[model samples]
Target chain A: MKQLKIIKIGGGIIDDAASLAQFLHLFAQVDGPKILVHGGGKGASEMLRALGIAPQLVNGRRITDAATLDTVTMFYAGKTNKAIVAGLQQNRVNALGLSGADGNVIRAVKRPVREIDYGFVGDLTPAGVDAALLGALLGLGLTPVICAITHDGQGQLLNTNADTIAATVAVALSEKFVVELHYCFEKNGVLLDVNDDNSVIEKINLTSYAELKEAGIIADGMIPKLDNSFDALSQGVSKVIIGHALKINDSLKTVLCLN
Target chain B: MKQLKIIKIGGGIIDDAASLAQFLHLFAQVDGPKILVHGGGKGASEMLRALGIAPQLVNGRRITDAATLDTVTMFYAGKTNKAIVAGLQQNRVNALGLSGADGNVIRAVKRPVREIDYGFVGDLTPAGVDAALLGALLGLGLTPVICAITHDGQGQLLNTNADTIAATVAVALSEKFVVELHYCFEKNGVLLDVNDDNSVIEKINLTSYAELKEAGIIADGMIPKLDNSFDALSQGVSKVIIGHALKINDSLKTVLCLN
Candidate 1:
């Protein structure tokens, strides 16, 4: 099987123009087929405020009402996606930006009316991804840059989590490729000490990840992120990498393995 | 040569929900491979107004400064493009939405400041389109839904005119396909009398078009639009159709030939 890298970048890099440019430069240097999945940055929130709509959050997750969905769709799928694609183009990468609605690449179901009613949020499963179409796009020498927007295939667009999108896509494409999922953000890696910049935990297997969580070294917000990474590994992803977006080509990053 | 229909829809239909849905349904039924290029509708202007940015226009053409470019890019490439793609997806068309920056399918040069500084606006030529990539996309059994946003290939997004994008794309693809360029607007073809819905001009050739212009039968804004259609015909586009968006399947329309 061929090798494919699925890289996901969060708001920290996207919100800063210089860091995003540096990341794009490094990404262009990566040799092999890859897909970039990006999250909506703070820009969306700013725009929401500008438009006089205050964002609603429940348990660190956005409560995606219709207006918020519209704003985030514009920011993520529109402005940020286009900017990143144009930057990659300038760096000589033939990048094509996509919302899940494009090509019906990711058909998601609206998170059912649960306790909170997360208005227009989508919950995706591995079965929702169109792996063959993605493979065809990569076969065409195009790197797809996906935004955190998906449709229900019944004509309703939904706000989705970018990390979940990347993981799901990585798992789907694993049938055809040795998929390496990279979660790129502002950190060097999973930190050994919360306040130390150089306290990088280089590698974490499933056992040590449990120990690290039990030891309180990987507590707080990193828990869910690492949980998601391990989930991808268990589902046949070859490896998962966590590192700074600008340091993608460097060896100083955390690597996760199922073992 | 294979037949390819390149359809361009203006703002009027897009501004209305039912009409846009009807147009998409009609578009999905058109046999053979096709591409849809849509203009930035009133949504952008509404957004600009909501954001408290007064839109600037010079002689009916928008002056796309940096802020204006950002808003239009979000509306056209983001919201409108995705809405159309999802709608087509519901109708079972494998629609892939694109900004010109995506796949580097179209690259444009920023309009130079001669008499007017149109800011970040792009002026496209036929040579700027990547016909082979488009052919590859079409070969993949996907319908491309292109928005009127292009890149300068130097990390800048330029607001492009959708009509020119359609015509230029038609000319570009003529090498591989028998291209029929359809300009679908609110009116049912070029009316002999602007007030009468039944005054449809069934067919117009170069000679008759010239005579109509001399006889003042085609005047005002319609003159420039027809000029563009004839120019496209002369440039090797197989034909240009002018019709109401909803009446595309019916024969109550005008067809321009180079004869």
Candidate 2:
């Protein structure tokens, strides 16, 4: 069976160029096919401010109104997307940057809101994800660097969460390939003790993840990350790893199962 | 009949906040159904450089190689797209930003290269333009701000020229609306002499444009602008105006009409 990996770099990992570089180095050496999806949550917010626009978020996702939508497209798709691609190129890795809107690779409908409108946030429909096209790109020896942006049916920008994007891609590509979800952050791994970086959990199954979340040990952003990891696994992905971007190799060894 | 205008701002016009502000002021006063399509050629290139990526342009268009394509999408679709939308919002215009790939609004086939491989550039087919969806947005009292980025059928980034995009859009919407193509620049208008900025020609018809080209007076980038303008007019656009962005009202008097 062919090997495929979907590595998602968190906003924290992307904020640090050094960590991103380290992750890219490991990504370049990895055998088999891989797709890299990244988020520019903080970067995009800062950029919007510099341009004299206030960033807005709705339901943990960026509210991509007309103005905010343009900013996200420019910053996420233009600046951060190019920077990541350039960094990969410097390491002699052939990477292609893409938006979910491009080629309808990720088709979606605007997430309908009841009271406060979420503007252009989209909920992915199964019809929207294109695994065959992505598989072909990987077969051509190219790594796809995807930005977390999508579009509604009527030509609108929708800010998508990168974690969900990675999970969706992993599930879509899992049947024909061994899919591994690498969730890279600044810390070593999912810690058993919140204060201890050395208390890295060697591995996590779906049951442990549920227990941790239920006990409130994993709250906030970590909850979504864990949820998305299990979602991918349930959809047929072979493994899911949550680890530090800089020390990804160690985490990969612990998390990825080949069989 | 509801009058509709397709105002196109060159990437040059929106390079800075001041210029954007000036354009937005003009944009707000235009009371009609309108669509705004913008270019980010220079802005995208500059941001690419900041990220240490050398942008390669073939035939005056960014060659969307794996690296450059990634950068272009981020900059054009994300950064530049948002800045314009934000500027419009700051000026009280509810402008929404969108790309050609949205809802398959603008689809095209990858242009087959003749001399050099223009990696990921697209040639717009008539079937690719989405006028109805755009018309629906205008009918809903929203000005659509479009970025000149599109996707080929195979999920590849296609570097499309802004002028062509504007022209195609004009033609696409011509049946239901009176479409006008406004080509705004820093100069007062197209001048007879290259050295004199004050030598702004008040008006010119298609015949005069041909005469100027025949005399070798029109050269470089101006040639394409005139070509695209004429293409729009010939394809049923009500008129095409070329002038300073701030002098849109004055430029309206010099509109080139086929009739």
Candidate 3:
């Protein structure tokens, strides 16, 4: 059986058709069973603003308030999901779109609040999944496109993070596959210096991650990305790559661990 | 506490924007804790064909073969999921998109093949859901926009059905809130006369369902749908509404039962 690889595309990289097309072109070259997890934070926020709504974020996560939730359901599931599917089809890649709520794929409980409130956010619990279904789709030579929304036991929608979703999926498939998590962005790679483009770090192991954190090299948004990568690695993923969505060849060099 | 409602959007309705926008507009008026679960079957299949890949279905369920699995991950999670989010945002709904792989929301085991080989499909099992997380989100007045995809215990992506997803979610939340399920489509309602537009049934109860089924008034696609609805009702869903997606007001009128 071919090994499986899981890749995550950041909101920054997925905001445009050109970037998405470029990414898909490269992705078509990769071998084995692969899955892509993506974020729509930037687009979703922009759409909200255009609709005269103020977007709210709780700890960097979007708050799916009543109105916002409706917008997201329509936009993410209806528009963005189809655009991606159509894009892949235009590129000659078979793609099927879906959400966690479709098959109780991700059963969630509402997020608990002690001090701050995060509306419609859910924390996931362990539920048995149907791997045979996935294998069957792969066997039929179709690509599965998944969205980052789930449901609680009672069929309520929940907002979930893309990085976490990718990491968890990688862990779940690690035993039978080689999970390769890619964090595609505009940057070349993980930079060692904020100002120097030449300060890209070739690689860093788990042991060295703390040192970088202590040195204040990894902070803010990068923190969650790295944390999610490490989480997947610890859970038996083969590799985690962070690089540019465009220029896949250049990123592939970094991804291949040839740096 | 606001009552919880679970609204399920069908692929037929979500296939186009005009219908989806209208659906979201109505969803915005649901003044309570609500969750949105959506499907992308038709879109996924159409996209797959355009990409030169043939879709495989086993007994009306998608066969998630290796290539199909890859296609769906990209189509469902990356595209359809975001599209829905974007649409909701257009209406000022702060929707966040997600898959089950995030937060381990829904865990499952690799479903063993029975009669036919349906690769990569998953069946749901009982696992604790994080209701507190959802409750917090609802408490904060956020709506959840969910996609139908989940992960197995080993972390592999599993293809699942939208109706089943909605049913399980409804059951999960029944204990804490009033779970109102709306399965929307282009049809006015379940029809007794397949060719007669006026044959729309106002309501269906558990007692009447058998007669309808026996008389062959409920067949084909409606069978599975009604089965799912009844399952939810049996499991304690407060109500199930089946109607046309475009006739929003009329659709809301077919309330099957109220708890």
Candidate with the greatest DockQ versus the true structure: 1
Q: After aligning candidate 3 to the native by TM-score, how far in Å is the CA of B235 from where it should be?
A: 1.1
Worst 10 residues of 2 chain B by lDDT: B250-259
- Residue A250 displacement in candidate 3 (angstroms): 25
Candidate 2 has an fnat equal to 0.23
Candidate 1: misplaced stretches above 4 Å?
none
Predicted candidate 2 versus true structure: per-residue lDDT over B83-193, tens digit per residue: 566456555565656666543567777889788888877788556786776776566455778877776534355778777888888888897898878877777777778
Return the lDDT, model 2, position A63: 68
Between candidates 1 and 2, the one scoring higher on lDDT is 1
Among all windows of 10 consecutive residues in model 3 chain B, the one with the lowest summed lDDT is B125-134
lDDT, model 2, position A181: 84
Task: Give every prediction's interface RMSD.
Answer: 0.5, 10.7, 13.7
Model 2 over residues A1-259: C-alpha lDDT tens digits? 7888788887886777677777777777776677889988587787667667887765665667876776777777766765666566556666666677543467567888888788877777545776776776576566788888876534455788787788888888886798888877778777777898888777677677667778887788777667666766777889988787777666332353322
Clashes of each: 0, 13, 146
- How far residue A157's Cα lies from its native spot in candidate 2, in Å, is 14
Could you say which candidate leads in lDDT? 1
Q: Residue A171 in model 3: shift from native, Å?
A: 30
Q: Each model's fnat?
A: 0.85, 0.23, 0.02
Task: List, for all models, the DockQ compared with the true complex.
Answer: 0.90, 0.12, 0.04
